[model samples]
Target: MTFENPAREEIKKILERADNVAVVGLSDNPERTSYMVAQAMQARGYRIIPVNPNADEILGEKSYPTLKDIPESIDIVNVFRRSEHTPPIAQEAVEAGAKVLWLQLGIANEEAAQIAESGGLTVIMDRCIKVEDAITGPLKK
Candidate 1:
């Protein structure tokens, strides 16, 4: 069964309240989609924490090897990995007490979304953070 997500108003509320974002599977290569999206979000005034085992830093922020390695509380877990890899990441997001689990464009895992939602996290799938931000205007308090 597919779960209908929270309304746009609630999503906007969460986005506005979120300050720290953990970008899972982010890459150092500027040409990659993950890097480009991260750059865009950062430009939009969000604190982006890069999570990648392959890099020490990306876009001037220290990169963690995994979500668990990120010390601070994360408001959103922006997943850049494939659908098959998402359940574990979703679990990590839950364990880390994240409020949102965002699956980037072209990536969706219903099971992961269910798990995240079951764990009380807001789930956003098959969406681009940058596009959403641009279309929704700046997040309001």
Candidate 2:
């Protein structure tokens, strides 16, 4: 399965509009990329939900084991897991009613992107939310 990516303008719109971002595969280890990215997002005032089985807390917020465990509706699911592991996470993000599935820089899975898109979720692959935030602007109106 395959589909076209949202245009640069549309991707920017989605990123600018999204509020709560659930960071799947987030880690408590401060050295991890997910942790660093989540912290950056939080510092910029975006709600960052940490999803990791190994963590109870990260960046002073409660960590969830999965996307389904997050109480609030997530605007975007920033995936930090490997490409091989993204399909199920994408499925979970869809099941959790996320508006977008964002695979981090260097991570891309056409199958997962297709699933998320087919389920009415916007998909952004091989892009870093943190980088996007830096280059663009806050996810705000």
Candidate 3:
């Protein structure tokens, strides 16, 4: 079966209620797309938890080596990793009890989507969270 993302209104609601975002593969460098997107989301009031194994910190937030390393609850697990690498992350997000599994633009993995969905996560694939927030966020300025 073809993978279809949730409708726009549903995505809006997800952004509205979300408070914490665990950004997997978020980069320390400001030039990276992951860094820029997470920074914008942070400015919009969502707590940004950087999940980067190689970085000590990103955007002033302490970086965790994995989703399981995060101590608090996660509203969204936003991923910047390649499609081939997402299935394991999906499992981790499930283990971490995240509400949503969001794969960033240009990345989508069927196995990952299935895993997250089976684990009760609302999955959004191949969409830019930053753009979605700007378009549909109630907290947008």
lDDT of 2 by residue, 82-122 (tens): 99999999999899999999999989998898889889999
Q: Report how far off residue 4 is in candidate 1 (Å).
A: 2.6
Q: Where's the lowest-lDDT run of ten residues in candidate 1?
A: 132-141
Per-model TM-score on C-alpha atoms = 0.94, 0.93, 0.97
For model 1, the stretches where C-alpha displacement exceeds 4 angstroms are: 139-141
**Window of ten residues with lowest summed lDDT in model 3:** 132-141
List runs of model 2 lying over 4 Å from the truth: 1-4, 138-141
The per-model lDDT (C-alpha) reads 0.89, 0.88, 0.96
Candidate order by lDDT, decreasing, is 3, 1, 2
Q: How many clashing pairs in candidate 2?
A: 0
Best by TM-score: 3
Ranking by TM-score: 3, 1, 2
- List runs of model 3 lying over 4 Å from the truth: none
Q: Per-residue alpha-carbon lDDT of model 1 for 1-141, expressed as tens digits?
A: 976666677767767888898999998999999999999889888999999998999989999998899999999999999999999999989999999999999999999998898899999988888887777677432
TM-score of 3: 0.97
Tens-place lDDT digits, model 3, residues 42-112: 99999999999999989999999999999999999999999999999999999999999999999999999
